[model samples]
Target: MKTMKTLLSASLALTALSGCQPETEKPNILFLLVDDMQSDAIAALGNKNVYTPNIDGLIAEGVTFTRTYTNGALCGALSMPSRAMLMTGRGVFEVQSDGMKIPECMVTLPEQLRANGYQTFATGKWHSDHASFNRSFAAGENIFFGGMHPYEKNGHCSPRLYHYDRTGQYKETSFIGEEFSSKMFADAAIEFLSTAAKAQNPFMAFVSFTSPHDPRNQLPDYGKKYKAKDIILPTNFLPQHPFDNGELAIRDEQILPPPRTGEQLQEELALYYGMVSEVDEQIGRVLNALNATGEREHTVIVFASDNGLAMGQNGLLGKQSLYEHSVGVPMLIIDPRSKKHGFKTDALCYLYDLYPTLCDIVGIEIPASVTGVSLKPLLEGTTDKLRDDIFLAYSNQQRALVKDDYKYIIYNVEGKITEQLFNLKKDPKEMANLADAMPQKAAAYKEMLIQRLKEQQDFCNIDTPLWWKDGHKITWDELINLYIFE
Candidate 1:
């Protein structure tokens, strides 16, 4: 029998003889996740208004996915399911959004990496349950275990931080308002990378930032950098949403009431962009830390968001809708070993695909439960497209299918149904509804949507026309009243 070391040498020799690339050292992974960040918000991605020098620096060294989206959202709290899908490499419809828990049986990305001799660390917004966080990461710090924080009138508050002790018990530490959430999390991540520099095993660090989400309270310095009047409103912005989409009563929609003025939207945009810029600075700090530790070229960086936000798009102020602004998010990946930097692909992909893609990059076997396809081939320039089209769903209210340059959207709920179709290349804002002129295309897309639903085991009854029930067509007010708001 061959000795273990002799067998490894022989395997590598055989691989070299076959003209295959030899295995290299596994790279460290730094995954940066932001909340409610729209695809167009990044300055590097052509959003002329936002300032994101740090994120843009990564873009210069990475490949940007120009058309990535969240697979689905069961409710208005979209981040829960979005993060769940990201953690477990599962589809939105297949996970439990409530309690934000990942099944115990499932292997999370961090968990798998830890099992493969990588030290896993996490910090920042953990909207998912504590059990999943504790299970996935070997260590954590400055973690927020719940959803959005309460509004601070003076923009000051004492937030608590939590971390896992050696005994595995989570301990809480009181925090002062001096440091903002972004800085706190980034500081923790920088410290983690510094410590990881001394460790033999490579580290996998998840730095999740909760910013550009809500309360629009930008840091004073960052806020002063932008003027509201100079901010441009989205071209698709509407004073009010035309009809009820089953989520009209959600808290997110109430950010501004009907007849939203351009001034208010611009003001809000300034503050939101300010927060994004601040987050970009924090990212820069972390990157500088990576470089300081002499790990810059040996680490892989992934920057993405849990989901995108509307921010006054299509007469909406939230992510409950299926528009590009609401569902499409920025995904940037930088691998130092690859020569294909500053590349981009328009291929359709869900955020969950990152799990398998990272696994493929690190030479780990993807988990059996993972439904997302690896983008290694696409990233390596061996393929142009990983998928041809995409499907999006939000609650039982909205459905959309995107193929080529055409997007078909359906709003079905209660006793009303509406259809919309737009040639995205011609009308990226979805300003033109071609369902009437293109009935055949709409019918074909409806069939295609049904087929995708069946494949995903979504059993929503969408066959029947929802225009009339009990001898009356549903009114917008009635639909709004049906929602139970907190």
Candidate 2:
């Protein structure tokens, strides 16, 4: 058995070095990324009441990921790092924070695709350090939208953020949030695709929408779709979250002043749903544009969110906890060349995996520094599983590891650690805590959690040092400047 295990490991190492390719011709890539979208907001993903026909149509045409996850729960915590990981195929730790530069040595996904004779274009929400964005893509737009404005004014008229890097030059374009950020991004993406189609070049277009985020504002038409009284409150709504559970005080207050009656709860949910529906409508428009260009069949479309939000779950409105509602996101990938349409996989997967997975699907070689495995086999219906275990870590505050039917979360707050375990198969809602009842199981999971963190450290060069001091408070502008210059 030992010898067989060693042989298998050696074979995997060789396979990794040799690289693998897909049988089909390389396909054009269209990435539809949304900000602060919850897992249950889309109709195709099991939300019966939400109006997401455009997104649902995409699901009907492609495979819907049932167990997709993001690197972090909050935009401020994971947006930049997660994006860096996606572009570089490396975890957040692999990239160093030297002023505002991403590690120059790392080759981003866009750069690799460009090298393979593909053109890349991106619009909206480049939250990562300027260094990463500059060196990564062929053309860039709206990268500065992340820290430029708060939820107040529609993000319209924001300056165009660009980076001049080795791959190519980046030019700024005008952006406005008046007509929903998703629609604006889609318009930019459609323009890029129209040009690419004319040139007959395989292209990658990343359309990022900054919507369904805070300030809870929505377009007047979308907001009018549902009356506040008609909205439905979440089943887990709580007047107040039990204790802090070690979450930030400011964030905790967002969910406070809890709705006194179901009507109040419904009012808040209506606004939230309104924001989601607005994004969905924009998605429809983008899909229609693709069809109109006659490139829908030749393109591979991927839909995913940066992170999940807690819309009244556990009395929480934001994503600052380790709960499933906060960290788990929806991911869908539709490849016209694959036969696995309408299939769902329960395998554990992370957003970081999309980088290598794309490389695999498009018949390109992934770099050696990438920590995620290719999901091509799973997508191709050749394999029933992807990974045996999935690990997640965020902001030095929460850590979690999940296996088949069990998940363990370790909450680290103010230098103290607390643990919780759940049998996901039995209680998907995670209402029951099995930690105290099963000491041996908890201990075993803890060991696995430690090993997972250690592996991430070794593979991604993640440092355990806390960059943000406890109790340190900074204004929004200051934080933005710090991130921009970091």
Candidate 3:
């Protein structure tokens, strides 16, 4: 009887131990970050001109954020700080930009994930400080590929040739610019994935693409894929932007002289679309590799851009102004563990939230210093509120606060404040600015902007630039050699 009782107790204990053992089935993460692709360029996001079938397919199999935003629109303006925010789960202002060093005290997303047993790897574009920030991954590569350069020559700084090892050390490599960089990064990522799969270790692969940014060069064959005459011009296309509205006049001067007649515009659009299509094709390649590795179903894929671009929107070619085309970005998160797939959320979520969201999806406790909230609840279709209001600001040009249906922009450079309250449900174009009609509502938004500015100023240690002073313009090479290399 005693032996039988002992045996029964042992069996019960084994059962209890089995139930208590933590689930070891962790999900792999694949993050695809595009440099300047706009939200409207993807077919899944209502873009009719360009077709991004693979990205759209990912959206159909996951959650797509309709109201996603980036921290800044311009490349140098917000890419570094915004990326820092996304990596650290903190706001740009919260990070101390002392010269070029990212403070050592902060616990970054990759570092945290590494602690949680994730084998992390990254490739392409680390526009932030030295390529060696802990925010990236344990083993990775970073290339400072944000500027414009000649397509055929290697004289200028190319986003493609730039590369760094995990410690942020620049690898000695020849500069070939975009095409080669994309291929190399993709190849490196595939190798990393293969290693992780063999080791049975969950991996976080961050693939940042530098194509479709500038000096727009497409593969010769890819460039030939589209005919210039077939391209369509945007409805908002204009010969010249009516007014500066406190915008940088330098970029305005760069506008290709008009009669930007149908022919020229179509040619430019064709090249742009061709570059985008090349990126889409590369994305499909990566996804196929994942499937071939038998990790497709267990992996979570995220597609997002740093910010949007204005190929021809609002008569702009870059992302400097405070416009929807510049601020909004495409953000899609796919979690196979969740029941809610192919869902759309219009909640105001920022790129900074991605750090915390990734942690949540992997069942890891987010560090206390992170300012962003977990988006899993929102992705799971459990939360109705993602953010009450999103604060948008540029270096010294514009500051705005966006609620559900209203957007208020304060042009600090020109000492002019403009408010546009759009019934997004009715007019998504934002053709009408209702500030003149609804003074009280505009005032409320202005107050919110003021509070946000104050908080940002306090945290960032930034003295708002005096608008009366003239701004300086530096050449691409000069800027890179001076500010970046120094």
Residue 8 error, candidate 2, Å: 49
In candidate 2, what are the lDDT values of residues 306-405, reduced to their tens digit?
A: 7787767776666766677767877889989887777877778877788999999888889876777787778877656778887776555667788889
Off by over 4 Å in 2: 1-25, 73-76, 97-101, 141-144, 147-149, 154-178, 220-224, 251-262, 415-417, 458-486
Off by over 4 Å in 3: 1-24, 73-77, 98-101, 141-167, 171-179, 250-263, 414-421, 458-486
- Residue pairs that clash (backbone atoms under 3 angstroms), model 1: none
Leading candidate by lDDT: 1
Superposed model 1: Cα runs more than 4 Å off: 1-24, 152-157, 165-177, 218-224, 465-486
Better of 2 and 3 by TM-score: 3
Better of 1 and 3 by TM-score: 1
lDDT tens string, model 3, 270-311? Answer: 777766777787788888888888988889889988777766
Q: Give the TM-score of candidate 1.
A: 0.88
What is the lDDT, from 0 to 100, of the residue 275 in candidate 1? 84
Tens-place lDDT digits, model 1, residues 180-275: 778878877887787776666677899998887776764635322679999988889888788887777789888777678999999888888988
Model 2 per-residue lDDT at 405: 92
lDDT for residue 297 in candidate 2, whole number 0-100: 89
- Model 2 TM-score (2 dp): 0.82
